[model samples]
Structure formats: C-alpha cells, structure tokens
Target: MSMNSHAAIAPSLLARIGAPVRRRAAFLLLMASLGLGVLREAALGDAWRRPVRAEFRRVLREAAGGGFSTIAVTAALIGLGLVSQAIYWLGEAGQEGIVGTVLVTVLVRELAPVLVGFVLLGRSGMVAIVELGAMQAGGQLRALQGMGLDPFRLLVLPRVAAFAVTGFTLGIIFVLIALLTGFVAGSLLGVVQLSLFGFLDAVLRAMGARDFLLFPGKLVMIGALVGLTSTITGLSARRGDSTATLLPRGFLRGVLAVLLCSALLSLAV
Candidate 1:
C-alpha cells in the first residue's frame, strides 16, 4: 500500500478499536455528571418547592417508613446468625475481648450498608424503575416536557434524595438491631456476659474518627447510587421496553452500583 493509503487505513482501524472505549467512557462520565447534578439540586433550598417536597415526603415515607418492619426482621436474623456466630467463635478462640471491634469493622462498617442498600434497592429502587419506566413508555415524560417541567429536577431528584435518606435511616436501624439482637442471643447462650452498655461502649470505643464519618457516608452513597442507577435505567428505556425487561436490568445495575459505591468508599478511606 502507498504511505497515504496506509495512513488512511490506520486512522480508520484506530477509530474502530476506540469505539467501545469511547462509548464506555462517555457512559461513566454521564453517570458522574448526573450524580453531581443530584447533589447540587439537593443542596438548593429552591429545589424543595412544594411539589418537590410533597413528592420527596411521599417517597421517603414509602421507602423508609413502609419498609421498617422488613428492615427490623432482617436485622434480627442477621443478629441471630452473624452476631451469635461471631460471639461463639471469638469466645472459643479466647478473642472475646475483640468482639466489639470485629462487629464494628465487619458487621456495622461493611455488611450493614451493603445489606441495607440491597434492601432499599429491592424494596424502593425497583418501584422507582417500574413507575418511571411506565411513565416513560406511556409518553408521560414527553407530556411533562411539553408542560415545561424538567423531569430530572421533578422526578429524579426527589426519588434519589429519598433513597439516600432511607439508606442512612435503615442502615443505623440495621446496625442497632443486629447488635442488640446479638447481645440478647449471646446472653441467652452464655456467650456474652457484658452488660448492654458495656458492649456498646466497647464497640464505640473501637471505632475511630474516620469510622464515624465513613460508615454513614457509605450508607448515604450506596443509597444515592441505588436511586441514581435505578432512575437512569428506567428513564433510558426505549418504547419497546416493558416492566418485565426493566426489572431485572434495574435490579442488576442497582446491585452492582451499591457494591461499587461501597467498595469505592472503602478504598477512598
């Protein structure tokens, strides 16, 4: 081939190779931008106008209040299984003194956020997807746009904020319930002799300043990601999509996003 022909083919070949990379990069950037936009709108008092506040209150109620029993039950089971097991094994190993640290580091710091994120995603995130997906599919989004409403500000922000708030609330409840249940179970089994106050004090003492900040941060971030991923997945649906297709995709993305956010936060700290 001539040098000019070689140059032409090389550029075309490079472009072909870079196509997927470019697309992936663009998707990541878009997600990051949307996340920031949510944060910015959340910070603004004007974003809490009556309609937005009403929607936010409704979602928060549905996501957090409606799911309280389930969260409590799950936390109890986690306490019975994980906490009891940990107490037993640690006691047997003569490492009982470190029970609080272990629980703080493993159960509260890590598992609580992840499990709460999953719960929120399964309970509320899927609802957001189905609701938004139906609207998008039925052309309601177009109607809203025609009426001069910004869908992101109206629909997306409130829902995402609800998820974040619910995540934090549920996470704290999960940790407390799990620990309390574990304490009860441990006492019944003769595995834990410490008073409730002593047990909690130990755990609190083991937590560092960073843990105080990072634990809640993880919950909030995971919640926000769950909301954001579900909303994006639903809103991006085509005319051909239905709830059947949207549910599994949104669930998978929400799970991956929760885990990704948790991992990233851990790495950051």
Candidate 2:
C-alpha cells in the first residue's frame, strides 16, 4: 500500500479499536451509576416492608464490621506514617510543634479518605468483582434471570450500601485516631502541649468544615464508584481470556475514578 493509504488505514484501525473500548468503559460507568440509583430507591422504599428492613439491618451490620476492621488497618498505617514524620522532624529543632497541624492536615483532609477508599477498593470492590465475575463465568447471573430476580437489586444494592456506609465511617475513625496519635507523639516528645482537648480544639479550628467535609464526601463518592465499577465489570466478565482483562480494568478504573472525584471535590471546596 502507498504510505498515505497505510497511514489512513492505521488511523481507521486505531479508531475502530478505541471506539469499543470507550463504549465499554462508558457502559461500565453507566451501570455503576444505576447501581447507586437502585440503592437510593431501595432506601426510599416502603416503611412497612419487612424485606427492606432486613436488608437495611444486614447492610448496617456488615458496614459496622467492615468499618472496625478498616479502622484497625488504617490506624496501623497512619501510626507508621506519623512515626516516620516524627523521626524526620526530631533532627530539626523548633519543628516538633507543627506535628499536630501536619497530622490534622494529612489525616483529616488527605490521607484518611484516600486510604479508606483504597482499602475498600481493594477489599470490597475486588471481592465484589471476583464474586460476580465467577458468577458470570458460571452462568449464575443468567440463573438469577431464570429465577425472575433482578441481579442488581439482589446482588449489587446491598454491597453498594455496605461500602458507602463502611467507607464514610472508617474515614472518620481514621482521622480521629491519626489526630490522637499525633497529639500523644508530640506530647511525649515535648513538642506539643499535653492537653488532648487543647490539641483537638486547635485541629477543629484549623480544619473548618471545608477541609473536613471534603474527605468524607470523597469517601462516599469513592465507595459509590467502587461499588458501581466493580459490579459492572464483574457482570461483563466473559469466559476465557476476557475475564483477566476485565478484572484489571475494573481495578484501575476504580482507582482512577476515586482519584478524579477526590481531586475535583477538593478543588471545588
């Protein structure tokens, strides 16, 4: 072929490949949003509905358990991070007092949401994806159709609710623990006043609602996105080589969604 024709053909081929990829991605996101909507609708459902109450209770229980486990893991990670910061600042005089401020900034505004999101993205998001993927591979999703059940309601709603609640709760707990750890470290090292209440007051004043609200909002958005993305990706998983590709795509898409939402929210606030 002529060089110009070859170049044109290459562009056309690339566009053809890109189009389906983009469509699939968009479809995945659409499905995730639908999952969130389903959860919202269920929450607004009947007051006298026994099934709704049972589902709500089950979701809350799962969220509490997940939040507790997430808190322990987040605390350990934040503690390690704080210790590293303390050691680094130890060599510099007159720098220890700022540790409390640093901790508050990191924990309340940045680390907590991102860390909790990542934890859920890995734990809940991945698990949902794998479970659904396995089901898809095993024809279980089709089986649900045969049984006249909407898989999104039965499978995806509970998870979306659980992840959203767990993520927001864990984010709050992570910030609280990080603040306490920073205060104790500073006091022990004589870097800050020994009063916990005083430190907390300072943090509250510095953090205003803008900083505090941004992280929690981001956590909720991340949870919602993770639930949606994982479910759609899992549902789309086909047998053979396609399943492997779908799994990683789901994870990377979840991470990117969280980062994008967090950044936008932070900027807007």
Candidate 3:
C-alpha cells in the first residue's frame, strides 16, 4: 500500500477508534459527577442544603411564571397528538379504554422527562452554559472570586437546584395533561366506557411504587448530569477559541451524560 493511502486509512481508523473512547469517557465522567454531587449533598449537611433548597424554591417560582408558557405550548402539541391517537384507537372498539393508560404511561414514564429535559437543554441549559462561559471569559467569575464570593454557591448551585425542580415539575404536569387529553378524546369518540376511575386504576396498577420512585430518581440524576456537565464544558470553553464547536460538543456531551446515567440507574433498579 502506498504511504498516502496508508495515511488516509490511518486517519479514518483513528477517528473510528477515538469516537467510542470519547463516548465511554463522557459516560464515566457523568457517573463520577452524579456520584460526587450525591456525596456532596450528603456530606455538607445543612451548610449547602439551605441554599440548595432556597434555589429550588426560586426556580419553582420562576418556572411557575415562565414554565407555564412552555408547558402550555407543549401541552397543545402533545394533546393534539394524544387526542388524534385516541380517536383513531376508539374506532377500533374496547382499545379506547386503554387510551388514558397509554398516555399516562408513555408521558410520565418516558415522554415527559425526556421531552422536558431536551427542551430545557435547549432553552435553559444551553443558555446557562453560554452565559457562564461568557462570564468566565470576561473575568466575572474571577471578579466574584476577588469579591470573596464562592462561584459554585453563587452560580452553579442555584442553577443545578433550579434545573432539578423545574424539570421534574414540568415533567409531572406534562404527563397529567397528556392523560387528561387522551381521556377526553376517548370519551368524545364514544368507544368503550370512559371512566376516570378505571383509567386511574389502570395507571396506578401499571405503575408501582418502584416505578414511581425510579422516574423521579432518573429525573434528578438527569438534572444533575445536565447541570454539572454543562458547567464543566462551559468552563472548559473559556480556554478555547472555538465557542461554536465547543457549545455543540458540550451539548452533545451533556445529553449523552444524561442518557448514560439514566441507563445505569435503570440497570440497578
């Protein structure tokens, strides 16, 4: 083989090898971050606890104000889809009774968290990372340090708490709306018997205490993963000249981190 051909092949081969290693490293780092965050939360007792709690409250307030807008918009879109599916299934007879069950299970267990996380990733997480990156680049973080303020406490902590609370709350709301919309559509279509109690029973029976526990657990882990990964990636961006490349790479890493953490936790459950 010609040296030129070998060189080309080597680059492609190296790229293939590097991709998996990078993914694995990102997954490992995500797990480490989750472990470290959980440990810190446990060890600090009330020192960081009050601030985190306060930040979470603040986040909920902000989300209550602004999160509604996004939730409303998402609800409309999701409601339409759920309703359409319910109507279609209702035409098939007794399957309509399960519409509410399907909606709740899919929305609460899967769609809501994943969708809300992705939305916040784009809406909140990206903005947070960029803003913090810019602040660090402009020496604001350093200025705060000089002013004797802890950047972690002032910046990272609140955002982390906010993301967890907001993401989880929005997820729950999304699921509720989806189920309700499905139920209404099923009733309107006159398929089977549309009883809220029956639907609730189905949902409750399908989702055990373990499932309920796991969903929130996954959400919290995903929230922390997004927060820490974004922070580290943004901080790293300060040292680089390529904000464009760094931002996308950071976003992808953050998402992958969330998925990895969720998958690992699922395995343990």
Candidate 4:
C-alpha cells in the first residue's frame, strides 16, 4: 500500500481500537459530572426551588413508600431466621453476653447497608431505568432540551436526592423491623433471656463510634451510586433500544454498583 493509504487505514484501525476506551471515558466523565450536580444540589439551599422540591417529594414518595413492603418482608425473614439462629446458637454456647457484639457487627454494620442497597436497586432503581429510558427512546428528552429546560436539573438532581434520603430512612426502618422481629422470634422460642428493650439496648451498646458513621454512609453512598447507574444506563439507551434491552443492562449495572460500593465503604470507613 502507498504511504497515504497506510495512513488512512491506520487511523481507522486506531479509531476502532480506541472505541471502548472512548466510551468508558465518556461514561466516567458523565458520572463525575452528575455526581457533582447532586452534591451541589445537596449543599445549597438555593438549589431547592419549588418545582425541584415538588419533583423531589414525588420521587421520594415513590422510592421510599413504594419500597417499604419489600423492605419489611425481607427484614422479617432475616430476623426470623438469621437473628433467631444467632441467638439460639450463642445462648447454647454460653456466649450470650456477646450477642450484641455479634449482631451489631454482622447484622447492623454489614448486612443492613448491603441489603438496603439491594432493595433500593431492585425496587426504585429499576423504575428509574424504565422511566428515564422511555423518555430517551421516545425523543422526549430532546424535546425538553429544545424547550430550554435542563432535564439533568429537573429530573436527575431531584431523583438522586430522593434516593439518598430514601436510603438512609429505609435503612433505619429495616434495621428496626429486623431487630424487633428477630427478638420476638427468639423470645417465643425461649432462646432470648433478656427483655425486648434490654436486647435492643445491648445491640446499641455494642455499636462503636464507627458503626454510627458506617451504617448511614454505606446506605447513602449505595443509594447515590444506584441512582447514578440507573440514570446513566437509561439515558444512554439508543434510539431503537427496547425495554427488554434497557432493563437487563440497568439491573446489571445497579447490582454491581450496590455491591461494589457497599464493599468499598465497608473497608474505607
């Protein structure tokens, strides 16, 4: 081949090779940008306008309220089985004094945050994927853009904020439900020797200063990560992409984000 032909083919080959890298770079760039937008909205009271507040409330209700039943059912099951088993085994082993420490370390600190993350990812995150993906695929996002409205500000910012709030609130609720149900089951099975308040108090005492930060931090970070993942996945949907394509992609991303972020936060803090 001639030098000119070689040059032309080389550029084409390089473009093909760099395509995945370029896509990744773009994804990270948008993720960082959207994260900053969410932080800005959170740190500034001025960012919460009437319409934004309205949108925030709407998403909050949908995310927290809509996912409550799922959270309750999961918590109850964990409590009935895992909590009861732990109590029975510890009592039998004559190490019941450390029940609080074991439960706090294993259940509250680790499991709760990750479970809450999964719940949010499965319930609210999927909904976000569907709604946002539909908007993108239908060209409605472009129509909104032409109308001089910022979809990122009006849609994404509010939704992410709601997710963060939902994460924290729902996490606390899950912990309470799980603990209560577990205590009741243990008591009925004659495995629990302490009163209800005493059992709860022991768990509270076992929690160190770090547990306080770890619990909320993991959930909030997980929530934000899941929110961003779902939004980006939905918005990235190509024109011809169907719901079948979008859902699996969004779900895979959300699950990975929740698990990875949960693990990272557990180690970092």
Candidate 2 has a TM-score of 0.81
Off by over 4 Å in 1: 1-23
lDDT of 4 by residue, 62-145 (tens): 999999999999999999988888999999999999999998988888898888988998899989989999999888999999
* Candidate 3: residue 201 lDDT (0-100): 73
Q: What are the lDDT figures for the candidates, one per model? A: 0.90, 0.71, 0.68, 0.89
Using TM-score as the measure, name the better of candidate 2 and candidate 3: 2
Backbone clash count for every predicted candidate, in the order shown:
0, 0, 0, 0
Q: What TM-score do all the candidates reach, one by one?
A: 0.91, 0.81, 0.77, 0.91
Q: Write the per-residue lDDT of candidate 3 for residues 67-135, one digit (tens) a residue.
A: 666876786678668654654665576565565456545666666666667666766677667877888
RMSD of each: 2.6, 3.5, 4.1, 3.0
Question: What range of 10 consecutive residues in model 1 has the weakest lDDT sum?
Answer: 23-32
Instruction: lDDT winner between 2 and 3, please give it.
Output: 2
Instruction: Please list the residue runs of candidate 4 whose C-alpha ends up more than 4 Å from where it truly belongs after superposition.
Output: 1-18
Model 1 Cα displacement at 257 (Å)? 1.0
TM-score of 4: 0.91
What is the descending lDDT order? 1, 4, 2, 3
